[model samples]
Target: MNQYVIRPVRGDEWAKVKELRIVALKDPAASVAFLESVAEAEGRSDAFWQARAEGASHGRAARQFVAEGPGGEWAGSVTVLVEESGTTDIFDQHIERAQGHLVGVFVRPEQRGTGLTEGLFQAALEWCWSLEEPALERVRLFVHGENARAAAFYRRFGFEATGNVVPVPADPSAKELEYAFPRP
Candidate 1:
């Protein structure tokens, strides 16, 4: 929207970062895709939020971007974490390749259908491609198998199903579908 600006999150906007995260956790679709609960996020301390924002905004291995409205209210956000080759992940798997992991994607309900998400992804993927040596080979995201809307959107954006399925650690009965876009 013309009234909004999409850019890298600022270090001092931790409070707003917390607020947007709480709101995102409350979205109906969150239960299937996000691991955090609204109640849990609401319980975090201010210091935790500050640390989180600061790390995400400046961390060399990750980044967080936000869409701020004309009034400086956070409308949505997305974060990307770099997963390098040979590193072992919490999932007990070794990353045999270098890639960017897209996470914490959210767009407020009122901002949906206004092209905010596409713009957000553009900014994120562009940044990922801009990285230096061991340059990103791909950008990947895991979507709940039942999240058809999200899967459709990712498909439209040129990401393809990698046919790799990862079970949710918290809920073994659920599976996450891996999708990836190869760097151009």
Candidate 2:
């Protein structure tokens, strides 16, 4: 219901990607919603952002989608990364199959509940499914156990818990729940 266009981020738009991510990290839920802290992200060099943006821009292994308002404001974003079977995930767990890992999800505070998330997800899913050659069987995401808000949103989008929980990298004593959507 919001007047925004959903599209993929360009390789040259690394600055926008970095800017949006900074905003996301400042959010109240950032501590649980994301694995990186503002300090951690800020410490990275421009080369890191350039590589990230380039990968999402044209690489088959990953893609980032954004909801851009007419006035050039970025309302929201979601990224999908292809995971090959037999590889170790960020959590150091064995990946079971070729899948898409959805991460970096965020929406500007004012843009929440505007259907922007749905738009971003639809784009992310479409890109994931469009990948050929080691086809994806499911799409997955990680949600902090205490972050019921994000978990509920993922559930509404048809992702189900696989009963697998992993320790949070930032706080090993804590946990993050895994949810996934089987490809249709």
Candidates in order: C-alpha RMSD to true structure = 1.2, 0.9
The TM-score values for the models, in the order shown, are: 0.95, 0.97
Which tens-of-lDDT digit does each residue in 61-164 have in candidate 1?
88898888888788889998899999975456689888998999999999998888888898899999999888999999999988999999899988999998
For candidate 1, the clash count comes to 0
In terms of lDDT, the poorest run of 10 residues in model 1 is 88-97
Q: For model 1, state the Cα shift of residue 170 in Å.
A: 1.6
Q: Which candidate number maximizes TM-score?
A: 2
Judged by whole-model lDDT over C-alpha atoms, candidate 2 comes out at 0.92
Give me the displacement of residue 59 in model 2, in angstroms: 2.4
Instruction: For candidate 2, write residues 3-51 as lDDT tens digits.
Output: 7999999999989999999999999989999999999888889999999
